[model samples]
Target chain A: MIQIKEVVKTYPARDGGSVVTALDGVTLTINRGDIFGIVGYSGAGKSTLLRLINGLEMPTKGEVIVDGKEISRLKERELRQARQKIGMIFQHFHLLWSRTVRENVAFPLEVAGLPKEQIRKRVDQLLERVGLAERADAYPSQLSGGQKQRVGIARALANEPDILLCDEATSALDPETTASILQLLKEIHREMGITLVLITHEMSVVRQICNKMAVMENGRVVETGMVSSIFSQPQQALTKQFVKELQPSTQGDDTSGEVVELPLGDADKLVALAKEHGIRFSVVSGAIAGEQDDCLRVRVDGTEAQMQAVRQVLCGGERAC
Target chain B: MLTGIDWNQVSVALGETLYMVSISTLFTALLGIPLGVMLTVSDRGYFWENMWVQRTLGTIVNIFRAVPFIVLVLFLFPVAEFLVGTTLGPTAATVPLIAGAAPFYARMVETALREIDRGVIEAAQAMGASRLNIIWKVLLPEAMPAIVSGLTVTCVSLISFSAMAGIVGGGGLGDAAFRYGFQSFNDGMLYICGLLLVVMVQLIQMVGDWLVRRLDKR
Candidate 1:
């Protein structure tokens, strides 16, 4: 488990003016055995927050507690000892090109000053776990990108770390590779019972594996909730922007040029208009994208009562009809 | 024509040259790598210091690198004498050779280290590695090829500098040439010593190139 309390990090500019604040009063807690997702755009200080948890960068203010120890205040030796409990993976793979995959995976154990034979056994077990046992002898340059990331995964897990922090772990990967890596991360989380914390701008990555989620903007947590709940009902504007992009329905404006009558409170208008003229509506994506009286047209005439029931069940605001 | 030259003296000069060059190269490398790491660590823009220390170091290294090796030999005779109690033998002569060669090699090492990706450093740290671990494992191993190439350059440069050790009776191949070939203007001796110097330089270059290639091969 990790606890962050009011952490702030600022770096002075070379021009000697106002400083750049990377993290400002960020407080969050990550429980054990949970894949916590932190989503934000570029420059949202997501990477900085992740670095603080791993003890790679100390916070300028407050404390970061990991495994019940205050990591932010730890000395070099103590911090290193504490960091052995935390593993991390990066988007760039970070495999040592000069070393074989086995050596890369073995580096952390070697750095821990473990016995050489133990390191060898651990690396073999890790490489086998990541399904890269056959590629153990191969150098990073000799392997494909996905295989290289597999090696990185094996290396991160070699220490048997209690927590794994992934910083944009799949952003550099292709879609299928990203999917496999995400699945592998999920499996690793479940199988090892390690706490997983990943930060990314990709909503799809969150959709696949995250249980608890936090959306960050301008170095602040704007919204936090469950994955399915956030997908079905997002609170913040940024959350809506991300969730709408994931929706299967909702194309371009349906009623801007082509109108639809969902046969609701517009029943009288539909009859009066039907007497004068017949209106033909085409269905696309089983939902429409249009607005009347500040109410967005979410569905059309396919299911009339369900729309009202959805509206009645979800009475959001005064804008809802 | 060179058949008349003293073969015994030539062999001695060749041996002494080998002694002087290798010793100086080894000494400078020992002194240089630490200095190079310090230079990178203490670089003003990278570290917290002002530009004065960096500028001062740059000035000193450049001053040494810019001075001709023969002048350096003459310049450091007093310091060499103070350090070695006598400046006449190969051991004494090696003082200035190392002094002159270290900054050059240190600069090369600094360049090699500076070229390593900072991302590798961050990744190493993220793995719970200490700064020393990153330096030994990530920085040194990743920069090995460049460091090998730098050593090659330093070896060849030190070999070239060995010719200037003839001053103060330093007694390498340059002494043989000065005593018999260049100063006395013995065409036969001159041709043999000159030919020998050329051969020596060529051999140094070949070994250096081979070592670099061998070490650089992944």
Candidate 2:
């Protein structure tokens, strides 16, 4: 549904008279109905990329094709028209605070010049969908962070947009709220088949809903592919680092005796080895260095004989085991 | 028994002061609002985003703002004479009052517009709202409370300016106070006019605060 071709975005430093390349000749494609995630830290240009897709910002170079239209080349009128099919939510849940939730949701429809009755009906339905029906009369200030985000979601989906762009939609939310919001997003995707493009520094967000994902670093898409493949076997070093960050760790514990690095395929053998030696071992963390194979960093605790047995099984006779 | 006090003259002066302030305020709102909107939209990264246009318009507003209101009233005498055919009464007083106050109000409008979160504007743009629609629907409504409060401040300034308008042959309470009270050495007249001005300012502030609170759901 979206094709970003060699897009580059540069912003001039507001004070220093220097140019900052926000997106440096990056390219990626997002299929329709796919929940695609662009993961990056601050200043990685993921948000900039999202803006380009919706024509909020034109690319300094190359084209952003959304639903077969080159958004970068579109005139203001055409771009605005194109944008009606592309809805967006923000980290801050940028609802017009002066407006009630229902009115805020109705804004896009109003902009579309939908009839008043129709606008009201549609807003009511959207509020129902986002579970904010009772808060229709409440202004944004009265809503909690999650509720505000729900209103943001309702407003974005008001025009029945084909694409929903979430710019850190749940970043400001607490963990529990983030999970609920992610679940809501998944439900929306499942029901409507609307393409979702979310960018965040949070890997757990991508892991939760994204089917396809991209890893952005220093304004470049260093890696991109199916989420499962990327999680199981990350090709780039940065991707491996991100994947590693999500793995459960037993670091900083004073109890564990030995830490072992074993291939993912050796998990069974390691268990059997631990059993033979009467050692207790747990998969503490793991990292998939694509070329080096997926490895589990396990913590093992037991007497010296048990440690010796584990070392013998894994390392064979290569060392002191 | 009270001596040389003329209640009719006091009432007339009050009426003229009200006339000058109200009329000038209306024009200032009409003119200053658009100027302020223009300044905001043309700002860098905003909808219009024209550096030259933004800077030129900004400089103009600044120049007008920098000129002291009294000097501006005097400076605008010729234009006032050309527009109203006389630089001597309430009608003439409105010319300098608007000229002096509009730019100041425009700056206030710009400030109010600036206070709106850029993220809100970005969200509007992302929804495919046209520049005009963003201004009319998003910018104006979101900034309404601040704009109303700013307008209140502008009205208070205009009231003060109208008093100065007395110096330019613009007859109002200030004129009556100056002639019958200061020049004629009538302390009572000055005190009454001063009290009325204070009451008027207080009334404007109270009304403005109420309106702002009413408008601000944020």
Candidate 3:
């Protein structure tokens, strides 16, 4: 569990210029067992928010509470102890090039002062879990980007932390690698039940695995809600833009037409009935509306008389038209 | 050409050169590594992040490095006399040798440490590693190859500094060349000493490069 309360972070300019505000009066709560995704473009304060969760950067004016402890006020020594329970993975993977995979994974365990025997056992298990057991002896330079991220994941999970913060964890990979990494993250959340707070500019990443989501712009949270609701009914302009980008494109054609929503099972029936009546119809988009709720959305194009006939069947032949 | 060269004296001089280089290099590494690590960590945004310490140490290293080695040896004559109880032999020469070379080597160490990726250090910190752990486990190991190369360069300089110590009656091949080759006009002895110094430098460089290549995993 994490709570960010009215947090404001400012950094003095390097050239003795005016201060820059990275986060302004931001509040967010990530519940336990949540794969919470924070989506925003660069400079949207997404990374600053993730860093505050683990006390990597202190807020200038507000409190960051994680697991009920105020991270903003903790001393350096106390923060070090607290950080062991909050693992972070980076877009660059941030692995120590001098160390092999096994040693890299054992790093957190060594920092936690685990015994040598215990560390060895734990690292082996972690390597196996991330499917990097065979490459345990390889340096980061020898592995591909995907393998390097697997090592990062193993190293992050070494301490068995209660939360994992991913700062664009898959942003550096190709699309295929990104999908595989995202699937691995989903598996990690399902099996470990660890809370995940991921920040990325990619809306598709959030839609793939995140259960809850937030949209950020210019150092503030513009929108936040369940992923399903935000996808179906985006409230803000930026949120709508993100949701629209995910829609099946109309091939650069004008989208002005009659939009209809029906259950997934009834989609084929409507298409057949429209075909029999000589009405032009096309399926616009389809998505899982909610948990166990599948819906099909389509766009129908025809004359006013033709539209009336389609609505008549749905209105029970009343011809209220 | 070899007739005028005294083989016994040349051997003794060669031994003295080795003695001076080995002792000074040991002390230089011992002093320089910690100074370099301190200079690196005390820098702004590093683990220690102390502006005063970084600036002060940096200034001292620069001051020592800026002085010419011959002049540094002359200036440290009193120190050598006080520490080694004499200013006339290979042992006494090391006092100034380390003083000159440690700061030179420290600067190299700083550069090597600076080359490390900042993200690696941040990763270590995020894992809750203590400051000591970060320095020992992350910074030092990551910069090892460059550090070794730096030491090699420092050791070669130390060999040349030992030759300069001969100007002050600090005994070595340089003293032998000065006494027999320049003063007594024995050109053969001068060539032999010069040739031997070149050989020593080449050997040190070869070893240094090999070690760096071996240590560099990236």
lDDT of 2 at A295: 55
Question: Quick one: ranking by TM-score, best first?
Answer: 3, 2, 1
Binned by DockQ into CAPRI classes (incorrect, acceptable, medium, high), candidate 2 is medium
Error of 3 at B80 (Å): 1.6
Could you give the DockQ of candidate 2? 0.63
The digit string of per-residue lDDT tens for model 3 on A104-213 reads 99999999999999999999999999899999999898999999999999999999999999999999999999999999988999799899999998899998988789
Per-prediction TM-score to the true structure, in the order listed? 0.83, 0.86, 0.88
Q: Which stretches of candidate 3 lie over 4 Å from their true place?
A: A248-321
Backbone clashes in each candidate structure, one number apiece? 0, 0, 0
Evaluating just chain A, the predictions reach TM-scores of 0.78, 0.78, 0.80
lDDT of 2 by residue, A1-321 (tens): 899999889987878678989999999999888889999889999989999988878899999999999987788888888899998988999889989998999999988889999998999899999899999999989999999999999999988899999999999999999999999998988788899999999999998888779999999999997675577557899998898899767255523576666667878988787667677776655545233336576667788877788877886422111
Error of 3 at B176 (Å): 1.7
Decide which is better by lDDT, 2 or 3. 3
Order of quality (lDDT): 3, 2, 1
